[model samples]
Target: MIALLIRDLRLALRAGGGFGLGLAFFLILAVLVPLGVGPEPATLALIAPGILWVGALLACLLSLDRIFALDFEDGSLDLLATAPVPLEAVVTIKALAHWLTTGLPLVLISPVLGLLLFLPADAYLWLILSLLLGTPALSVIGTFGAALTVGLKRGGLLMSLLVLPLYIPTLVFGAEVVSRGAQGLAVNTPLALLAGITAGAVALLPFASALVLRINLR
Candidate 1:
């Protein structure tokens, strides 16, 4: 499982393997939104949390297909399925690799992006905390979407359709955490909810993803 994790990370870092694509897209979204929305600091600050959350969510989608597509294409997935490592563990590791490559960068870079959006100074910590709690769910849920679509050609659009609805809970709670934090309100409710969603997704989604991958592989 560790070897598989390392291999996936290495693959993601390779050119054309989707390591930087999501980050680039995220940066572009942050840069373009300010240009399009005008320079009013108040207005930018008001929308910053939602915009950042949405950008991170969409950026995650950019690499969802890559989670399984390359391995599926080269027949490596079949080999992994038959290996001693359980498919559930493989699915979990794939999600972890996705988070490390796509989600982690987004979390790290979000503060810089926040500055562009005039995000409230007090909100930065909550923004990072919310993203830290929420992005693992995004990766795990995205892995499920990828597993569902792995055997189909041109599945990226379909995977996005399938995954977006599932992403709503995480997006809502995550954005709410930052919004309330920025307002100096109690964030405990939404923060707890976001953390719960991530915990549940990480704990349970890998089994479902593995089952879906098995079905698709067959």
Candidate 2:
């Protein structure tokens, strides 16, 4: 499982890998939104939470298809299915890899993006904390979507369609945490909900993803 995790990470970081693509898209969104919305600091601060959360969520989608597509294409997935490590663990590791490559960078860079958006000073910590708690779920859920569409050609669009609805709860709770934090309001409820979603997705979704992958592989 460790080997598989490392392998996936290496593949994602390699030249022409999609590792940088998601981050680039995220940066572009942060830069363009300020330009489009004009230079009003109050307005920018007001919308910053939603904008950053939405950007991170969409950026995650950019690499969802690649989670299993390359291995599936090269016939490595079949061998993995037959390996000693359980498919559930394999699915979990893949999701972790995706999170490491796609989600972690976004979380780390979000504060800088927040500055660009004129985000409230107090909200920066909440933004990072919310993203930290929410992005793993995004990766795990995206793994399930990828598993569902793994065998289909041109499946990326379909995967996005399937995953976007599932993303709403996390997005809403995550954005709410930051929004409330910015306002100096209580954030415990939304933060707890976001954490719960991530925990539940991490605990259960890998099994579901493995089951879907098995069905698709057959």
Candidate 3:
């Protein structure tokens, strides 16, 4: 299991298709915003948090297909299904590795792009915090969609159809905390809820993802 996790992480990083592509997409979204909304720093500041959150969410979605695609194509997924480790554990490790590779890096880079949006210094910490708390859910839920669509050659639309709606609550509370923090308001409520979503995803998504993976493998 440890080997599978490490190999997948290494492959994702080296392939320039998982975290790498998502990060590039994230950068593009951050850069395009000022162009779309105009160059006013104040206006950028006003939209920075939401822009960052939305961009990160979309970027996370971009790599969902790769989660199980390679494994399925190479027959590793079938081997994985036969492993002594429970399918839920296999799903959990994969999600954790995905988060480590994609979600974590996006959270790390947000503050820098956030500066382009004129995000205040105070909001940076909370924005990063909220992303750190919220993005695991995005990654885990995406894994479930990826698992479900593993055997389908053209399931990208269906993957988004299945997983994007699940992303709404995470996006809402994550943006709310950043907006509130920028306004010097207490962001505890939204931040706590974001944390709750992360916890809930971690606890529940593996079972869901495993079930989907099983169906695909069968």
Provide the TM-score for each candidate, comma-separated: 0.99, 0.99, 0.96
Q: Give the count of colliding residue pairs in each prediction.
A: 0, 0, 0
Worst 10 residues of 2 by lDDT: 11-20
- TM-score between model 2 and native: 0.99
Task: At residue 4, give the lDDT of candidate 1.
Answer: 88
Instruction: State each model's CA lDDT, in order.
Output: 0.95, 0.95, 0.89
Worst 10 residues of 1 by lDDT: 11-20
Q: lDDT per residue, candidate 2, 159-218, as tens digits?
A: 999999999999999999999999999999999999999999999999899999999998
Query: Considering only N, C-alpha and C atoms within 3 Å, which residue pairs clash in candidate 3?
Result: none
Deviating ranges (above 4 Å) for candidate 1: none
Superposed Cα RMSD, model 3:
1.1
Q: Tell me how many residue pairs clash in candidate 1.
A: 0
lDDT of 3 by residue, 133-155 (tens): 99899989899889889999788
